[model samples]
Target chain A: MHLLPKKKKKPSREPYREISPGSKPVKWIYLSIMLWFMGRAIQAAARVDKTVKAEFDALPEGFAFSLGVFPDGPYMVLGKNIHGQVKSLGRRGQEQALDVRITIKNIEAAILLFTFQESTAISTSRDRLIVDGDLSQACAVIRILDIVEVYLLPKIIARLAVKRYPTWPMTQKMIGRIRIYFRAVLGY
Target chain B: MDTKEINIIQHRQPGIVESLPYNYEFYNPVKICSGKKAMAHIPFELAAINAVRPLVLASDSPIGRRAIKLLTNAFKESEMSFYVCDDVPDNADAETVRRLTTLYLEKNHDAIIVAGDGAAVDIAKVIRLMVAEKTDDLEQFEGEIKLSHAPAPLITLQTFDGSGLEASGWATVCNQTFFSAQLAPQICIIDPRMIIPMDIKTTWARAMVSLTQAVEVYMAADRNPVAINYASTAIQSIRKNLAPVFSNWVSNKKRLALINAYTAAACAFSNNQPGPGFLLGKAMAQMGNLNLGTAMGIILPYVMTQYMRKTNCDLADLLRPLSSDDDYAGTTSSLRGKKAIRCLYDLQWTWHQAGRRKIPLTLKDAAVGRYLFPDIIETALKNGLPVFDETDCETVLEHAWEAKPLNVTS
Candidate 1:
């Protein structure tokens, strides 16, 4: 009687698969463009922006950080303070014990900030940025970014990007813009 | 820029101004039982939540012992059954949580009763989480992992009034913080008699923590109308009862007011995350081994000053509750905010004098040197307040280090 009733075989659990095959390539293309622009922005700031240099110099020696999107990040910038240079470590930055790490919530949020649709404060207040490590250091980094924005973006766009824009002499502004563009294009 | 343009710009900025069109969500499901003998309602509260057998947790401290005696005496005359575990140590870690969870499951307890201060409450929450999740590994639930099922019904009876864990959804198990709406106590009982043995210094510090929370709720960027109303009431209650409670002139009325303030502040704080002041104070406390309440009291004004600078929100509204009617009425709208800030500075000075300098007014006074500033900032950043950077932390800490009255004037 016991041998007459045999248990039915259970179905094996299936691994999760993406339902939409078309979305993968679109996401990669979007990420690539975002990373390219981010690299260009960092290069321009490091080369010509005095404020960025000063901020990096003020940081403790051997301080490093990563700025990226979460989960599927290209990790836009992995920078370290090397004699105040703020040089990029490229993809290798993730392995370091970074002093600060600022992760945007998603690709959409990143695009909004990078494209000047939303300001840093707006994005932060909206709870889009997830910051890790030293808060004070992160603040210093933000200030430096604001300064760089003034140089890279036009006055109208810069006004939208920052809370309060510092007044710079016309000659200094013109010189800073020219140098930023030249270095950004030539990769100096 | 013209005055009009400047005003426009200020209004448009997101965190700087409390602008409309902001999105936020808030939910709190705590039933509070208060009064002279609120602990008497425990049996009824337990029954409401359908909990027959509750595993009671109490610390070994005098207050904790007293709480257990009171609770046991009350339960002896009732039909409900409770098992008391009075050996809960201070700063209970993961191992303690596991042992307690095992005990709960083995005993077949249907509810958890945390009958002491913040630490006991925190331990019970974690134990409940472990039991509900049916796992000893608490790490899986850290940092905002939503629980699929409701936690075992928790009834918290406060022995003292400092920690806002009574109504908060967040709990720090070991060094890692965990959050779940279900973790908030199903019923919280606050009675003044429970805190009678606690010293004046501790009472004052705890009250100050509540005051700081209420103030931060009002100043927070994500604040809603519901939270603001609760915060305003909390501020008023704290202003009325703080000094009286500290002086040991134990009026049940004043004590009750203070308890209500703590509850209101907890409700508001539960709706929002801790602000810069809470984060900085927590960090400083951890680094210096100082009481969180004391650290918060010292750091409150400085953090408020930073918030005022960022938001440019009118602080005059605070004066009505914090100061006299004359002070609120006589002062012009423009000067009222400054007056309110000045009043907070004066309050700190007054408390410092009343305590006969027993309370350290400055970080330097507390023997916390500048060397720990970097560590403190890092701790604060990790805790919360992502909007603040290292520069803001430095500025706030440097100002707090000196512990001078806030420079209300520009």
Candidate 2:
């Protein structure tokens, strides 16, 4: 019904915008230092804390796990030695064929876990983490983390971070806490 | 009525009453993550299921775009990557699904992240199915429990409006119905940032369906204690949040509570069959004129009363969620059913007033004449739920025609 020839105009096209993923440098730095302390603390706890030693004993020898943020990480790698000792392998665990890789999805989620804002159980349930290997080993590692947390933080903060606080005698708690702290900080 | 007719109704009544609720099943695979940072957890959820690159299907509307933006922001620090195809068409036709499926295969997307209502989600689910089965025969995929193996991990982000099946293990792609618990999203993220203000009609209609579906599942004969817990939570949340949610001022917390109710209701419904109310609503929507939620809303009270009078359905438990605990406990068991049904009437009226009387109170008010009643019933029968017969359907229709949910019986 148009009297004149219809004219068609090409539609305008907008340029695509790329969404680049961001990094939290401050959180990564903070988490790196904390992971270092915790990695050493786990090695120290297995020597001093009988419960941690028993947990490590239950795991197969050479059981190694990487726990921290993915890609670039403030990560801790722990492995059981052939001599029945647990050792902190620093971040070099990624290079080894680890039994488990427990990764916090991001640095903020790691902050939530390390700052005692969220418990290990709560963080796992909330899906702030990813466990990529043998689930049984991942669960055991989580237990080790919980035990080490009790030694590192005060009872009030430790109680918030662990599912159930252990009923240790006042002396055992006091003595173990001191020994674990002394060995963890001094690397003795 | 003839003796034969009376016997059939009488026979069905006891069958429902004697159903062994003690021996039933309840299952839902979707893990709901709600709060401000819920979107940020999607990467972890996808990673937990071994999905690295997900195909993002979202609506192209402004609200959908805003939601996609908010969702993209959550992935900033997670080291995960996904491609966004926000140009999801409205119809979600087979052509679109096929195109997207080819695109998905071409791009090698590992999973699906659907960030809108039914259309986008439907396309994503169908695409997931085609890719999982590695076939183009969608027709053969129809029916219940068809998927033999779980597909790639799919996560859905609810933008406060959906087809009610978005979170359920059901998908209607190009009129072919597919059902499987595996088809349901592994994670349902309901962030407050995605709660957009929608039309009042759509708002209350969705609310009404949530309320009715909760009651329907709670009253189902094969209902389990776990499903009842979910249904009860939905009902209680709907009852408490309906008023404030409809007020002029917008409250994300209040609406988020309703969204949680919808999730609970969908979970409960997925565990059970489609109730008579839902079936008829679906039929009305299929007629091409009515909104499914609005249709369910209009007929819900009448259907509840019908079930109360005909079947030995125990509705006294519904009193707890319909009203206060004091009101529920104070009422005698015999009167609690009627009180609960009466409470639905009051609740519907609240929506009616809030919508400025534009919300239909009866079939006639909806401009759906009695002539269309038989067609709706016939279409409902095709749903094949075994929950309603012709007579029961007619009875509900007649009562709804007159807006008399409680007029017949005391």
Best-matching candidate per DockQ? 2
For B180-222, candidate 1 gives per-residue lDDT tens digits of: 8788888877766676534556766887788888887767767
What are the runs in model 2 whose C-alpha is more than 4 Å off? A1-26, A33-67, A77-88, A93-103, A114-188, B1-23, B137-145, B219-221, B248-251, B324-326, B351-359, B364-371, B389-391, B405-410
At residue B294, give the lDDT of candidate 1: 84
What would you estimate as the lDDT of candidate 1?
Answer: 0.73
What is the clash count for each candidate, in the order shown?
6, 0
Report the C-alpha lDDT of model 2 over B1-410, residue by residue, as the tens digit: 99888667644432233343656777799899887577877776777688887878777665567666776777766776667777788687787788888888987778888878877777777887888888776777767856655687788887667877777777887877877767888788888877776667777777877776888886677787677778889998988887666665867899888888888888888887778888888887677378888888888888888787677665877777888778876887678888988888998887688777767888778777788888888889987845679988888888888786454263
Write out the backbone clash pairs for model 1: A135-B389, A135-B390, A136-B389, A136-B390, A137-B390, A139-B389
**What shift in Å separates residue B379 of candidate 1 from its native position after superposition?**
1.9
User: Which pairs clash (backbone N, Cα, C closer than 3 Å) in model 2?
Assistant: none
Given candidate 1, what's the lDDT at residue A182? 77
lDDT of 2 by residue, A1-188 (tens): 11123346336333122355666677778888999999989999999988899989999978888997855677888888789888888685457788899988766678888888899999888778888898987898999999899888889999989999988898988898899999989985
